[model samples]
Target: MTASQDVLGEVLADLRAESAELDGLVAGLPPTGWAAPTPATGWTVAHQIAHLAWTDQRALLAANDPEEFRREATKYLAGPDAASFIDDGAEEGARLPQGELLAHWRTGRAALEEALAALARGVRLPWYGTSMSAASMATARIMETWAHGTDVADTLGVVREPTDRLRHVVRIGVRARDFAYAAHGLEPPAEPFRVEVTGPGGQVWAHGPEDAGCKVTGSALDFCLLVTQRLHRDDARVRAEGAEAERWLGIAQAFAGPPGGGRERRGAPAPEGDG
Candidate 1:
């Protein structure tokens, strides 16, 4: 379905802001910093940024040339390395010189933005596991960017200042509640649960029915971290009022694809990457 111009503009703007913030963080890193391992098992900081760039290029292709994307995707899925495709892409980009890789990411990001903004009416871009409108695609980009950026930040021992942009991530997390259950081979709840979380700006963002029996309430930041699988359930301070809601929190996921084996408890060493 087509998205309203006003809302699409807002999401695209947020996408740019989210990308730029991470770009700024990595742009200042020295060459050695690129080799420094992030929490993701085998990914260094370079791998993290490279993954974003690689995915951005794929998105650009999906938006600009669907026929080619489908052909390429078919070949990819049928290939021997299909299971490792994501990691393989990151590895290929990670091998480039830091300067070259950075430039590649910058160019790709710009082109993707142009493609998404210019998408024709009634066009829904095909993506792995689903299709999405320009706005949905852009919002997903922001979500992934934030999730991976968290890994980079953790690697550098930097604590990013939370922002209201997390609202996009939060929205996805809540929407994906059933996807989480299905991903885990469990039956989805029959009814939706009420979700309310306080954003970084101290604004309460609420979703689902107000009178729903199952309800979740807590800090938006914690919920985002939980859904992204960046923070373990035990480490998050979010609360749930019903059994279904509580169970959902344990498997909450905003990103598409297989269930992410979430990071270990707060004190445990984090898995190599958030993805």
Candidate 2:
């Protein structure tokens, strides 16, 4: 298979694996823990799971009919009862028992995977504002699952090991550096940079030009978490070096659209090492 196809396959696999992991984790949660606050502000464990399911359902709708997807999203955003609408949906999802909730999560994820698997390589689906191919969409899903899953795991004191598939999340994060800068109304640095993450078995996953103006180096997991905003820059284990690299470090993002204010690290120190 081509490199892109390989990456697509890996992303799909990771999505499935993560969905399963979330299912198992939620299945064991006590009723009280369902309403327990997670690291994600104003969201309990149930809210997180429901958000995933809702997002997947939206994606499926978008894939089938882009116009309908846009209309619904816009209507929801513009409605007088927008807050109540969202709250009601989430509340309905949160009310599901652990077993039913997990089953719903699995079903939604499987449907999304099937839709992605059926798409042609070049086909684009409406996402946020622009269009993205199946591969890009899959990559985005991987980043979201891993990042949000970290929040759940953190609240429960579960340490999830970094997987090789997390490279997709890292790549998305690297690509989003420019968007992060733009969100802040700053012009992205003109110079390019190199990103290298140490993965399992001593494998080094590097992206961008080898001799780029900047270099970011650190563990794959740290790099993924940092870029996804699951962990703050200071809280990450990765180190970046060079002026341009440091600039990119300050504006890295994985999510689409304008950059968020981002979560605080509480008492974490800025990540050390080379960019």
Specify the highest-lDDT model's number. 1
Between which residue pairs do clashes occur in model 1?
Answer: 39-272, 39-273, 40-272, 40-273, 41-272
Which 10 consecutive positions of candidate 2 have the poorest summed lDDT? 266-275
lDDT of 1 by residue, 53-158 (tens): 9999999999989989888888877899776788899999999999999999999989999899888766899877578889889998999999999989999999
User: How well is each residue in 1-275 modelled by candidate 2, as lDDT tens digits?
Assistant: 67777867877888788767766677778888778877756677897787677677778877778799888877876789654554456567878886687778778888889998877777788876357887788778777777768878887889776777777888888887877787668888887779999886578989889988789998888888777766667778788889767776766777764454455676643232101
Can you tell me which runs of candidate 1 are displaced by over 4 Å? 1-3, 272-274
TM-scores of all models?
A: 0.94, 0.85
lDDT at residue 89 of model 2 (Cα atoms): 62
Residue 260 of model 2: what lDDT? 46
For each candidate in the order shown, give its overall lDDT on alpha carbons. Answer: 0.89, 0.75
